[model samples]
Target: MFKRILSALSGKKSRTSTPVSSVHADASPPSDESELITVYDSYGREMKITRNEWRDNVLLPNLQQKWSDADELYSLIISGLNDGFVADLIPAAAQLVAIDSNPERSHVIQGIVLLENGQLDAAETTLRAGMAKVGATGTLLTNLAKVFTERGEQALADETLWRAVQTEPNLENGMLWWAAIQRERAGEEGYLQALRTVAALPGSWRAQLWRARHYLEHNDVEPARALYAEVLAGGRFDGGALMMISGDLGNNGQIPLIIELIGPVYDEHKHDAMAGINLLRAYQELGNADEGQALLARLYALGFMPIKSQLDQFAQVFEQMRKQDVQGVPIDPESLKFTTLALNQPIWHYGLRNADWFFAQKPEGASQVGFFAFSKSTDGAEHAESQREDELGRLSRAIPLYLAEAVHYWSDHVGTCYIQIVEGGGPVLSGAEADGQALFDIVPPMMKYFVTGEIGCSGEDDQVQWQIALSLWDCATRTKSATESGSAVKADLGALVLDLETRLLAGVGLGREAPLDSFYLRPTAEVLPVYLTELGQSFMLTLLANGHVPKSSMWGERAMLDWPLNMALHWPTLEVAKLMYICGLGKALDYQSDVLAEYKERSLQMLRELEQARSPALRLAPLVWKVFGMQAELHAYIRELPADTSPEHKAWLDRVSES
Candidate 1:
């Protein structure tokens, strides 16, 4: 079946007839008058020989023509000479030498006999001497060049042709050979120039074809297509040329016409992978998913398996999109989220635990997802370390190494940052204080300098000066070991936190201020929620005094404000409500109630509209209308919470329920 398909696609036809033999039986001899053999001498004169006299005189006397024909002696000699019958032709050569009217012809005949006898050197010398006597012209020069070319003296052969061309520039065959030689030496431009000159001559399809090939080689597809169209219009269906034009069109993104041009070739060569793969890509890009899938399945059947990593990557993208949909958000097409998802499946913990973090942001500039598999080997470990070092080095060399390090270290505590090192181990090593200190000791001097802020690595002149402030904080925090008393460590961490706050207020723009608030708020809220509770009270009083919280404080306040909303009902204090109202959660909760009511009314309106919709397509409208009903149900759930209830606490509960 496959072979049948392939044959159909390739356009091969069945052979029809047996070839006829040139040899014939029962051939009669020529009459005596017509049996005379005329030989053209080198001087443009002719000589004639009769059958009997030539054989008796030439054959018997020289001992080399014993095989001469009895009935047609001269005709047999001519045939024998042409077929290179050496023994029979030897006496003819001697006879020719005896007839000394044309010495150049005698020498040429002797050279042909020597060439037939495999004496190339003798043949070449004889031919050269004969050519000198004959006064070498186009015919003689061309013959000698052929000999030299066959002997692998291409330069000499080319020089001989050049001489021929100088004598007769209009020699069509000589011009073609010169063009081919020039093409071989100087490439496409030289070849095209020569080919164009040849093409301008009368009746030159070969030159036109050569010109078309030159265009195709340089990716001049439009001109190549024009040339190919001309050839096809002239009723020449060159299968190879057609295939080339189809591929050129496909490569240049002419998706629609690619199939039309190459369809015949595909039909001819069904198993051709290039044709199949390209067809698949074209269909896929056109959004013909069913056709694409069928083609891909066919390719699989033909023993081509898509890489497993690619499959996994596409799955991840789908999963990220699914998660983003639930968060009532649109995924940024340009974000790394889309890029990562498009490439592969999201990581296990992504969307499962860290979905909120992804959802909270606009999904812009998120890191692209990728996969890496581990193996137990020293080489693999080294490779992994080298890759990590290279990434770190780029960050260190371009920016501040300390700032980069601080961001990474801080993210480990608050975000889903993790490093899954596949160590072949008896016991696992942790990245706790002791390990960090040991690792710090072994780190390179430049890294250590940045970590400790000992060198004050900062300046407009310094390449990594942007990292100075973060480096200062990292140094202060690292000074207090994790193994030290909690109070001591807390004191150091608190001081650094205060310093960072002051720097942030000073508007350094060290990093994106909006997103970094979570990092700042997480540690402070988790480690010292009590302090934040008091801080929230003071901030609310300050906002009340000013009549509004500043725009810069809005995101930061929201980060801390969530805790008070959840605790509001339990606390019932003015401070809790004030923080909630200031951060906009109080307003959000009231807005949710109103939206739920509106959704309920909209659901009823959609039902009425559905009944009025008479067509089948309109009947499907009710299905979309059910989404409003769902929103109403959600709103009711929110409204049932007590007025004094912390909106943050309710939100957390809803989040857990949704999960």
Candidate 2:
């Protein structure tokens, strides 16, 4: 049944899941996908995920079809760029670059590929060279400005974007880009005037969104909502207007506001696939599968078919949930004692097989990323001189170190492009044209991707359209640690993580570089689950690191660190395993009588911390509704818990019941 749904989207039978590298091609095509020998190139071999595997690995409903020409192919490629067809996009992008009939798109797409491949300079050159040839068109300059921002060249980005706006005053995108810079640099007061200019422009969907967002940011509810109302009613501009306005709250991880604003619309617009898709993904991001699925069922019943690719994207998300819901893998019931020799030195790779911090040496130094099973190692004695510098402190610092490297890695690869269907498939999202012109060139919200995780991709950026990378550790840590002495709290950790990310993003020079839903800020709706999984992992990790199990807050304990150790529970990769360990831990403790007692409050506290702290992980989702859903499930479990519920917890549950 699933395969049939997927086949309907891609118009191709699901192929065998074998790596193309492992198979040798025969002279003739085989009878079926099984018989056919799939070829893997050098890149494919390196990724270990062949186009076939990436295609069939469960990114929803397989949405690829052979195109007659590269132009048509390019259009579809743009569509797939964010839709989990990234690996597939490589060859397609290359195809477009090779066939340079329209050199303009060729340059842009090639630049995108170059950016993806970590060639920032080459991408800049490609875009600049194109601009010299074609003049500073909004599309070229908008793209070029993105590279500049990724390179951390704010001056250049601002200048180029200014040029883009002047070069094409009518191009709302140029104006939007210009406005984003002004907002970031000058704040709302300085940004508003420019936005007004853009908003006043004829058929400026994005400009209007900026104006609406300006209002939203200032806590001016009526104008913001009114602006959204006006623009959404005007027509379906490629950019989802409501998202541009309300969704902008992602910068602050404003899950509640997003829910409040969109929830009613979601309730009212059940038949509007576009609105429903965003709402569903938002719910999923919030980690509320019940509501998301409820909406999904309604959408599916409505026969919402926008495009094959989007259907495939949605299918991939559902398939993942189905596996978890139906044929789920059983986690080991026994708690695993974590034992490791904590090395004090800065580590990136190598050393011990059991070591938490594994640093792989690069030619110059070492790989930026150092994959680890746990946060700060338990090297120091359990009772350190300062109690504050317990396992949580070390783990917190260690985590930033590891993740900052990823940000640095990502920073170098700014202006990265790939299709992720943010808005679900809906008649190919043919948004209404402004000024009787189709802004096929302007992809509404911006483009960003993350280091892929099994459940969903999570990156450090705070905003949906604007991506933040954790780059330049020394700068971020030094700057932040100096601000606050001694131990860095998780919020400080967020700052350290985000500053470097911001730097890494602006880092091209500091260094360099560097879901969904039309619901488009997310690439595709499927990523909602990934965000939920990531956010859940974060909340659990925070909660457990503080205390959980027989011995809570046993960070430095050698005999029994009863807390959740990084999961050996494989989710395709060890990184994801470590990342989502808390969720697994939560599941394990749920069975224990002692742990079940405070589970409701504990989980609720974790959720509250997510909001109070404004966690970076919270930004992973469009919303954290899943946190509430988890609480709901915990409440159900609380009811099932054998007697001996504490008065406080009982009171809380009573309060919940009353509500």
Candidate 3:
């Protein structure tokens, strides 16, 4: 059988009738207080909507006598009826019948609404009338079968279903119903017989697929494979077809066949998640680690978060397999080379201004400072120390962003992080290890100062310690101008970074006390590393979204975004924290992560806090609402912005509004 039955029906449990509890449920439309209406499927897919969405989408168009609208109202009609909108849907169904654009569909929905409302006689009469007017359609006859079944006339129900499938063997529900009856009358043999009967029809792709699945279930390989190929070559060969074939085959322990059948036809860009997942699992089970890794990359690029856990598991397994093959190997020198490099690219933040804007606003002749990420010390002494590659990898990017933001906030100079692009695509850490002369030549010509460093860890376990040594090079003078160093036990790395930030500020000749109303809050020691982690991840996700970084270059747990978003609410005054949170949200929404709805209420709660603030960051509230597709709230907030807002912020707001 197919993994999911295709039907234009409401409840998955019973397409023919909704429960009595649902029938008597409240039908009042949601008010503004209930900002979103969430609808979920049995498969765990969720859709967000507004209360009047049905009215706006279905009722109003039908009311305007738009005939074209009537043809497509079947799906919404199902939703409306399921949500206990029988009172409203009754009239809408009548309108569809009158529109006559798609008579069979309109009449079937009307019949289903009546049947669900317990008006069986009216339902039967309407269905009969529809058949008389438009001739027999599979859907209409299917409903008539339900009416017969409701009255306990099993014989009539079977006959009606048989006729329905005969009329349209491609109708999945009818074939399913007929085949079930056959199975009950006899057994597996009877079921196969029924499926074979339908499969014999000229355009019976669904029937052939059902029969093929039956064969696969019984371990009848040749027949199933032949039927599958025939169904695939038929006109209905598509993602859904492939998903069913692959899913059934996988369920029967035919892993290799999943790859053979699905790998060639699967379109990562257009196919559904299940097909890609089946193929990915096949690769993993068959130990095709490279293909598994590549497929995992493509799946992640799809940005659908519902299957994130599965993708992450495959990623971890693939990485482990890859590591197993390279545990003691030396680094590949060729992997370090790259082209098309640039610096000072803008990282996404909700309220923060862009780099170009900052460049234009800075004072003339202001020293342009560039901070490169500190690379791990490769010396034998450091190699013997306790170190985690993951932590080091994160810190390599985070530290430079922290230092550059510190300089921008504390001094008048225009400071920015300098990241070297990796060959395939990623921020390169080893580039920071280059000598002063090499760094001077690689950095932007406009940058007058460069801050580079090396981080080393020593000791072991609980006694582990971290050390950082930073040098400030005055490129104009072609010499090192100042140097600073700091060390702390592992737990106090944040404190180490704080001390270095203070010293680095002084080294660059701006060591004044922090402003009482500073624009950026110096994160507490506990929050420093986590906030920096969030900042680094935000930059990478932003790059991935903008196509600056390939999806294949990404690795690590999705908590890279999750933990940072959760921590953002704690650091309200830290602009980087807020930016990190928003950029994380942008990626989640862009990828259609399930977390978006999970976080929507929280986003709105944050918007309430943002609304009371006077900072330019307050404008981010509308974008948050916009990203959630909350049109009413977004427009209302846009109208309420202060009339004297700066042109730059206003222009940004206008673009967000229009977009």
TM-score for each model? 0.21, 0.31, 0.64
Better of 1 and 3 by lDDT: 3
* Arranged by lDDT, best first: 3, 2, 1
lDDT of 2 by residue, 389-467 (tens): 2223333333433433443344332222111111111001111112111212332222122221111112334321211
Encode model 1's per-residue lDDT on 1-659: one tens digit a residue: 00011111122121111111111111333435235554322111234655544445443443343223221223333444432244446556555545545555555555555555556677667667767777765544654565677678989988997676555444445666788788888886787787776656544444565566566667776776676556556643333444444555566666665555444345322334555556655654554544554444343333221221232233334333433443222323233111001101111111121223222232333331111111121211221121111111222221221123233223211111112222111011111112333434543332212121111222233242222222221222344221101111322433443444344223222334343323223233233323334333323323322323223222222223233333432343322232232223222222232222222332333234335543222222222233333555445555676788655545543553343
For model 3, give the RMSD to the true fold. Answer: 9.3
- Please identify model 3 stretches exceeding 4 Å from their true place: 1-73, 80-89, 237-239, 267-273, 287-362, 365-372, 378-394, 412-453, 457-496, 499-531, 534-659
- Which ten contiguous residues of candidate 1 have the minimum total lDDT? 1-10
TM-score-wise, the better of 1 and 2 is 2
| TM-score of predicted structure 1 | 0.21
Return the top candidate by lDDT. Answer: 3
> Model 1, which residues run further than 4 Å from truth?
1-150, 153-180, 184-188, 197-221, 250-257, 264-266, 269-659
Steric clash count of candidate 1: 13
lDDT per residue (tens digit) for residues 1-659 in model 3:
00111112222231222211111222443445335555432222345655466446534454344324554455446556655556666776777787756667778888878877778999899899899989978888888998888889989988888888888887766788788888998998898898889988777788778877878878898888888777766647544677788889999998888888778778876566778888888898888898997687677655444565577678788877765664333455564554433334334442232313222344666677888777777664322221123566678777877787777667766777766654445555463375888877777777878888887778887577878889899988999998888888878988889999888777777543663224557788988878777767766665565566566555553556555545755555665555566667766655444435545544565555566665444546666776779899877876887988677767766666665
